[model samples]
Target: MFDSATRRELYEFTRGTEKFYYTSGDAEVELNDVVYEQITISRSEIKNSSDLEKDPLEITFARDSKFAQDCLRSALEENVYVKVIKFQHGQQSILWQGRVVSVKPSGASIVLKSETNFTKLGRAGARLKFQRTCCHDLYGNGCRLNKADWGVQTTIKSVTANAIELRDLSFDDNYFRLGMLQSAFGVSVGIESSAGNTVNIIRRLDSLADQITSDADLLAYQTAVLELDQTIATRDALDENDPNYEQDFADAQALVDQKQEAFNIASESVFFVVAYPGCMKSLTACDRFNNTDNHLGFAYMPEDNPSTTRNA
Candidate 1:
């Protein structure tokens, strides 16, 4: 027994030492802060350690530098829309630091456990929502949570159930409830509306186009290209004496290039299909079925159909 401790103290202490209290709680301590939890201080030995050395016996300093980088890295990879600068989690070196496991069945507080093998959090589990900024940063982005239980301090990114129409996805620094946040820094953390996206697409398309020279000029240019192609296909002619032949060739090539550019513009957004087989087969079918003239362009059914397609 310790010289300072009495026999009665030792007997009383020995019995209390065997008590096993299991709990889940968070050790609300800041990073780099020094803290400790006594594991198994003996009956009388609890008092004799003060005089042993200058460093003293019992406390351990919790530092973030060792594992902070790792913790942040893990959270960012597993959680989406996570801002690393605002994220924090329990320091493993800290005696009582914990992680919220889930919400209790009652949907009030959360179930938590210490990150260490031999420790537990405060008196009992917390609401988890109490640590919104931390929990949201650590778990919420793509967390598979059930809304029927547990309330997180942070606003969730998304939820299931057709009945629960998502109101919005705006969040703040804490990524907590958007309706109640201190400030939303940088861009609004809101999902773009269907209308907004459509407008953006239209603006992009308009930006890509420029004014035409004139309808008359366009038609004349078209006529020149048609004549050049038709004449070129007719014969292998040496038109060195014809002053317009070179100009016609250039114009026709220019038209082809321009048309190709036009086709490229619609490449991703639209598609067309020329059905009913080859021209000969198509003409035959037209006669056999008594079908009228028709134009098929930019029709869609999710993917390309088995036919030649052209732009409208």
Candidate 2:
């Protein structure tokens, strides 16, 4: 029920050593108290947005209990869900959901591993396609999406010259609007700002060197890009000869591409465009789909419908 790619990604996520309790209905199993070798469990999450995997559980236990063996085997066949609860000082703190991936006997121990529901859904729903209009397609076409699914919720505390302070900050709540955006530019959740014919574009300013409006501004933008490039350069110097060098290089290029795109977007307005906030952009790298970062580009807003720009 799990794919090799999903397994590899999850295996990497749960490398560190930790101890937790395994729970399923009325059954609660105690884990190793002092790094016991026979009984072990590891958990982690897969690192993708659309294909985001869930935290999986890997268990290695002694084959002394027939009940344990029977339960694991039954769960694997029935595809039952299990909860991994983390406790601190005798108080439960974190909870994770997973399904049995494998249950096999190895010598004196029963080796069992369960994958997170996230990965399970990804694998099971891989062929299941849900057709819908994206923000990129329906940005100005009056096709609105439920903001609670995409936007975050946070409270505005105070606005400062350099930064905006927020209270009760929460992300991924869709209903929450950036307080600083609302305070400074009258931007709120579900509200679209009209460019109102005042919006104009500055073409061909694709890179730091190309966006040189003034010597001072040019120096500033160039310096910022140079600093970012230097960090990437340092990483490349350290890991260029590694096995994953090509993948690392691609990731770095994607980052540089994102930065350049941001610079180009900012060049549209003297201050900042109401419709073109960098925060609105999707920052994650989608390597499985062609290493593409889905976000606002030069042709994001249509020339005909310039007024409507806010999208989630």
Candidate 3:
């Protein structure tokens, strides 16, 4: 029921948010999370656009219709703007699409890996424990040991972030690079910068979102962090010498690593990720659950309905 200008504003905000979120393919977004989606009204009212994403708190400070109008007016007057990203559960998973206003850097996208990847990791069974990734063998020798024998990270690096600029992380002059990991439990990361506009914007929105729901904001914040990463890779195999590195990034590595560790932790965590969200939380995790994909070593989880809110 929003008008053209208002709709555009909402669209831009929603698109920007989604663009930021989708770049992080591995980021986890639960259902009914109250995410905003974008919708356009007409062709003529394309006048209102923004060169940049507005601080979400601005909505709170001016949480009235008049303020919203003034804010929209100022936003439209700017140089150019970007469209917002919103997910509508279409036939498939959440789908996102939008346009950019002025030219700006596009961050990485967020995607959910197929259930097969989960199955592969689950196959490692007791072996996922070594605190490493499969790429330990990438270096040819890896100290003459079977590269496969050493520990490797779970996720693989995909795209690079523009905002991230590496500083220095050394070890008694031997020096190790500052590293980030992307996985499941620690999957939600956030953006950061010693200097830049994006990180600042990220901090502000996350801070405000936290006031309302720490968990929700944290998820949104992490989604940004995971997207900044060019791609996921085990820390061991991640190429530090590769010239292009993101200074600001979250360790989704930890999340994947945690899953690798879950092989040993409570079987429930395994069922939750490996099986299904609904099935794991239920007494059925042991049997009734049934995802043909998750059937190995683990039982399948049942399909959840909209009313189901067993776990956050």
Candidate 4:
């Protein structure tokens, strides 16, 4: 209760299955044997507003704290749920709940900008539209696709700018287009296109870039590229009239593929799981997933509005 003199504030930050508990006190607080580490944490006042603009809660953590380091490492882009609780004696009551929308690193502290459910409700968008494509989200209620069936577990083979190569995917090219690539640490990147084992991401993944930059195999890929080029050049110089030219060219091509495969395997250090996104078109829904029955699109919808169209 607010009237209690012994009341303290407890903060809980959650990202996927991971949770961090902290308290703004002189020492750590133990509740049910779980320790909430003492940290310099504070949040802005929650307010009510009539406008649609978000009323963000700015939560700050000490720059040097372990939680701040975690935030910098991966939590900046991921959705982190924040809960504030008022604790007195052995009782606890939730004071605020929200999901982090953005993060700012100040000179002395890391600040998280978060918003409540009301912000989502106030967002400007029609809930549904009269379009030819499906209105439902992939793997959502109306789509009714099993996400687990579409997921593929693989390791990072290499990364070049916004493109990432994973263990060879047997699926056809563009199978993962408009899909998601999630790292073992829960950082997710959107897939723009996929071919063979390589995926082109919609945006740069800073966390993954940092990891690949320091990896020892970064140089290995460069060396592999040079070796592959040399092999191709040697194959191209072969004379067609020579008796052993065919065998020589085949051997050279084989070596190139082998070297490239080895290079991909050598660079494997991090694990990632990718899943294919559902198609919005009715024809794709039927041809790809054989899920025409659950298709939410109005494929036969008229191009012109019935109410507005008239014979000239």
Candidate 5:
């Protein structure tokens, strides 16, 4: 067994070595092959805390490239997951893992803030499940709970870290019963599903749990496929003076004239937006794998467990 001081020294030595990996979402985690560019790790630590007031970890880092910036930005906007790992001399450990909550500009660099996935579960409008989470709760040690004699089946419409949106309980005494259950067990109200198969359990995808084995090859798939946005209309019908005019001066004017004539003739054609959802590996891409397509597509993945709905 490695001593505590020896482990600390090993970690310091590894920091001075070469590089680390930052992957988005819970995909395949490997020591090699899937490694992206070498990243600079500034600060990383996990503090053991039984004290309720303090967080169990403190981690922060900076990525100088625009690709990293874009990836981090997309993660923050979509609430996607991210992880940083280091491997050396036959030993590897996860340095930090969390959902990217914020990405901000710091001078010429980009700053990323990742909180434990549980923290994201606490955000307003988060979906909740009654029985277990996608992966183990980082701070809660998987939030493993034994079934007790008492059981409650409450529909959780929404949740924040501290509170949950429950149905049918507010008017009835079930709310008080829930509060009593919380007081007795010190468990989060939205942790587990009941044994009966009546209500819908919350579905969560946690990439960090040992029970959840993700396909390594599929994990590398990155792209956030945006919903086909008809939000912006095609500019084919725009006049030169139109604010949304996209074509050149002559072409725009010609199109406007054509549109007017077409309207008089009752044209059967409908204009389609030629916009292609942006792809990564482009000049504007951050990490090649961190793009809008992957984030949007991930939403369609089936829930981790079968107790709840398949695709929500």
Candidate 6:
């Protein structure tokens, strides 16, 4: 508000719930009670071409700044969204808006390369294919499964480099394979496999250890389900006289009954993780999900070549 001709810029960078605000002025600026720290930040020209090609925006930050340090520590990367606002003549207007696509760190500064949403619009969508596996995304419209019904809120018993041990869970082993585990701190990680209550993660979350505590809770979502019916069937078919049968099939039936009962009685407040039966486009999988009518795959499609016949 000092001079009508005075100009300054505000930079807002966000990824998930993490945010960084900076202002390109000698003094700090406060908007909506949130302070934007004064920092050495600048941006490249915003270009719009007649051919509908939006030029990428490059924002440079001082190499020793918090933003640059976050980038180097792998906290902020290509997933970040950046918005630049220009304040001139006592008015504020959006200068540029885009997502960070790449980062380049030099000796003195770090430059974030971002592309506008128009670049995403120009990309092609995935084509549907006639495959044996269901093409529908988990919890997606085609899958017709509610994610909320398949998730459980549980406390973290312990944490390791590549895994997290959850508190006592009633679900069976491998129930959360290919699923998602979100920590209370909003850090979501892909589950590689789960045994009992221990969940192995696909990648290490750097900030998870610092953000979680003994009482930290996590939301586990069952994205892919293993075929438990097959296991039960195999256990049932085992010979009574087999030496290992008793040990191998111990509590198998009881475990199934326990899981089914839990599923039937599960509620939002229940700490137990409800198990989904299976994943795939097979009729058995569809039956397990109890959504056979919504199955998106062509399960009846002929697998053999019509033009050639082979003897078995």
Which one wins on lDDT? 4
In model 2, the runs with Cα more than 4 Å from the true position are 1-55, 72-75, 125-312
In candidate 6, stretches whose alpha carbon ends up further than 4 angstroms from where it belongs are: 1-85, 96-129, 141-144, 206-288, 299-312
Error of 1 at 81 (Å): 20
TM-scores, all models, native as reference: 0.14, 0.24, 0.16, 0.51, 0.28, 0.47
**Residue runs of model 1 more than 4 Å from their true location after superposition:** 1-201, 204-213, 237-312
Candidate 6: worst-modelled 10 consecutive residues by lDDT: 216-225
lDDT of each: 0.25, 0.38, 0.25, 0.71, 0.33, 0.66
- The digit string of per-residue lDDT tens for model 2 on 119-171 reads 75556442312222122321221223222333333332332332333333332
* Model 4 spans with C-alpha error above 4 angstroms: 1-8, 11-29, 32-44, 48-83, 88-94, 97-128, 206-283, 305-312
lDDT by residue (138-233, candidate 3, tens digit) is 112221222233222222112133222222211122111111111233222222222211111121222122112233443444454454342344
Q: What is residue 147's positional error in candidate 5, in angstroms? A: 50
Could you give candidate 4's per-residue lDDT for residues 178-292 as a string of tens digits? Answer: 7777765665656899889888987676566544332356456557767777877887888989999889889988987887787677556434555455353554654587777
Please give the ranking of all candidate structures by TM-score, highest first, separated by commas: 4, 6, 5, 2, 3, 1
What tens digits encode model 6's per-residue C-alpha lDDT throughout 26-96? Answer: 88887778788998998898888755355889889876575664554343323688899987876889988
Model 2, TM vs. native: 0.24
Model 1 C-alpha lDDT per residue in residues 21-102, reported as the tens digit of each score: 2111122222234222222211111222233222111211121121222222233223111000111233232122222122
RMSD of each: 26.7, 21.3, 26.6, 13.4, 22.4, 16.9
Per-residue lDDT tens digits for candidate 5, residues 8-38, read 2111111123233443323323434643433
> Distance (Å) between predicted and true CA of 8, model 5?
13
Of 1 and 3, which scores higher on TM-score? Answer: 3
**Which stretches of candidate 3 lie above 4 Å from their native place?**
1-176, 186-267, 270-312
lDDT, model 1: 0.25
